[model samples]
Target: MNSLKRIMVGLDLSEMDETLIRYTAFLCSISEIERVYFIHAEKSLDIPDEVLESMPNGMPADEKLRASLIEKVESYFGPDSRVQVDVQVVEGSPLKELLHWSKVKQIDLILAGRKFHMRGSGVLAQKLLRTGRVSVLFVPENIEPRLNHIVVSVDFSEYSLMALDRILDSALTRPEVRITCMHAYEVPTGYITLGISYEDFDERMKGFARNKFAQVLERFPELNDRATLHLVKQENEDDIGELVMVEAKRLKADMLVIGAKGKSAAALFVLGSVTEKILRYNDDVPMIVYKKENEEIGFLDALLGND
Candidate 1:
């Protein structure tokens, strides 16, 4: 949000790797990203013995692969890149290497491409989403690198508020861009067991949800001028994540931004239940996952606290 100064983009040799680079380029063109680290994590350093035998005896297999990958990525950007590009090649699990590099280098954002057909890539992405410390932007294949409209999912919780704040603080929510602050709500299933008619409960729940949405908007008065508020009511069999995707499609949003509720049991229920499902859905819309920070209590507060 604070104009990402450093970004690390994860790349594989697959065709989608270029898509990640182009996405990074698109962001850099619009924001203040200063340095871009393009990284490829090779699963192993070992090469086939037959191929190794053909190469010079003194050459290292890892070094050869590194040089080749660097050249290939460089070809995509050529020499006239608007931002500083640094190509890096390493050997390890992709998730592990990406997490380590981002943390050690103080990366502000991470960019990666999602392959619809690759189940393994999806698993790796989920692992990164859970384990990585930095914000990640997952760009699906064939997505246009534009930011005309963005949908930020909100539950009126601190974590969702954090996501909205990040988008507002950035240049992404400019005047030309249409921003939608969307919240999805559903009545408790127990209402049916308690003899409440579904229709009766739904109407009551929707009224409550509308009031909550109004309260949330009241807190951010400027949003009234810059964004639109949308409240979605979930049906009996609807999942929250599915509802979010349906809203995105209905709104024709170019991007989706949502916050992870951190690892606390209560927080996990919010992010893990919905955001995790959305990640698996892979609807071809780009998404930014913002993780909530661990709020550290002050010394004065700690001393006076009663748990």
Candidate 2:
């Protein structure tokens, strides 16, 4: 579990983007966040002819836009602030610029606002999860910046283990935090398609789930004393994503954490089907999508090879 020291927030100058900045401010008040960077990436370096003509001779359009965006971001924090704030305006696609900044600044966490209904924004969000290395926090509209109850989606994979580690690390620092480790299992569709007994099939799946849960408890003994485990069984007719959301709501979870496996040749980027689907339907709950540390090695590791 790594505590965030530096955070890079994506700023799109939208209403939801303000929510992200406000959420970051809340973290600064509660945690040990030392620095914040609000970055906006402009797609083109070239300014519109109308705007360029209005500016004084020899004045660069990019510089002027950067100054304006910085001022707008600064107003969110006001004059007095404990955390150091930096405003950046870069020219390129949002995904590329944000990814490069995260690596260069060694950002521990990346924050951005999300509205699932917006297709363009949704695409950019997926790009961040797929391509970016830093852990991402997608804050929905009207999210409280509080983590009273957290639901962590697990599947016993190393990616889920990484998510569990980060969630537990944060939970340890906060007393009386309610943590639920949720594992959703599904029955094979072939059983239902072939008209097999639903009850018998369900029972067999439950037996396997029980054994898996036991193994999970053994791997994370801390949960025995600190957290509760929730087992979910999904039949062929049930949507895994909907089931996850329902369980989280039943527990009244304030946040959800899940792991993302980085890009592979076949899939490009893998956060698993369930995790991505949950992201699609999510509206208000703040979700943290953490990537495995060793999955995509940096330049140094690539150079070193298997030593």
Candidate 3:
């Protein structure tokens, strides 16, 4: 993603819709986003008796929904606006429409509401983030948006590198903001077979991860303090996600950024277990999940039938 100019937001007509729109407006201003599409999908645009009595006869449901969304967006946007806004109401599954429209519209980023103790657990937004081609930013229902400091979960993979690059190159990396490159490493259980002590191997792992981070710094010489390294040891297979979140909370990070890294669609998970666990456990601090730029597209992505 070269820039966050064109973006999209998915609305489900719930209380989350307002939050999503408001967050999107805030993002557009900070990022200098040129165009934004606010879309809502419905399985069926059929009107019931209550809606029918409120509207004129023969008024289409999609148009009515579009008008409602326009009003909501206008309330948030200023009159002297440089951003172009379009409200669309489409039929069929929300997930498919989000993915399809993201590709068709060439969206750079996606913004959606991340509900905590709200009506839903924000699973649909997570699934959409996992399945789409574009990057997704999940905003909570009740948090002030800020990008002063970002914690990026780096595994030294190309995807993580891409994410860090995009974040630094984008508007989020202001002079006042800080970026943390955190890597969690685990010592192999089979190290005993090599006559290596646990403490020694753990030290070696830390050194190795630090060396990799140093290589990254060498490669990007311009990133003086724009990026810094933080190493964490994984105590268990399933705790890396929690460790990342807790560390982010510890660092008082405004956002947690991670890139999806995996192979073909047939693989068990292209998003990886750590990313999945993070999505499930994260209840605070907005996260932006970046999809692999050059992924092997396959049949499994257009999945679950709904959003």
TM-score of every prediction relative to native: 0.81, 0.80, 0.89
Question: What ranges in model 1 sit over 4 Å off?
Answer: 1-3, 49-60, 75-80, 118-120, 189-221, 264-272, 294-307
Clashes of each: 0, 0, 0
Question: Model 3, 33-121: lDDT tens per residue?
Answer: 88999999898888675864654456688877777778889998867778999889999888788887887788888888888777855
- Residue 67, candidate 1: Cα error in Å is 3.7
Model 1 weakest 10-residue run by lDDT: 295-304
Off by over 4 Å in 3: 52-58, 268-272, 300-307
Report every candidate's CA lDDT.
0.75, 0.75, 0.80
- Judge candidate 2 at residue 177 and give its lDDT: 68
Q: What is candidate 3's CA lDDT for residue 176? A: 80
> Clash pairs of candidate 1?
none
Q: Please write out the lDDT profile of model 2 over residues 13-54, one tens digit for every residue.
A: 566666777788877776777789888888986877686563
The digit string of per-residue lDDT tens for model 1 on 1-307 reads 3656888988776777767777777787777777889888888878676765634466687666556666766765668877788888788888778877876677877887777764345456666676555688888977879999999998888888888887776666767888888878777888978899988988787787677767767877767776777878877787777778878988998999998754533342244467788876756899999875432223212322324
For candidate 3, list the clashing residue pairs, or say none: none
Rank candidates, TM-score, best first. 3, 1, 2
Once fitted onto the true fold, the runs of candidate 2 whose alpha carbons sit more than 4 angstroms away are 49-60, 75-80, 117-120, 171-173, 188-222, 269-272, 297-307
**RMSD in Å for candidate 2, one decimal?**
4.7
Q: In terms of lDDT, which candidate is stronger, 1 or 3?
A: 3
- What is the TM-score of candidate 1? 0.81
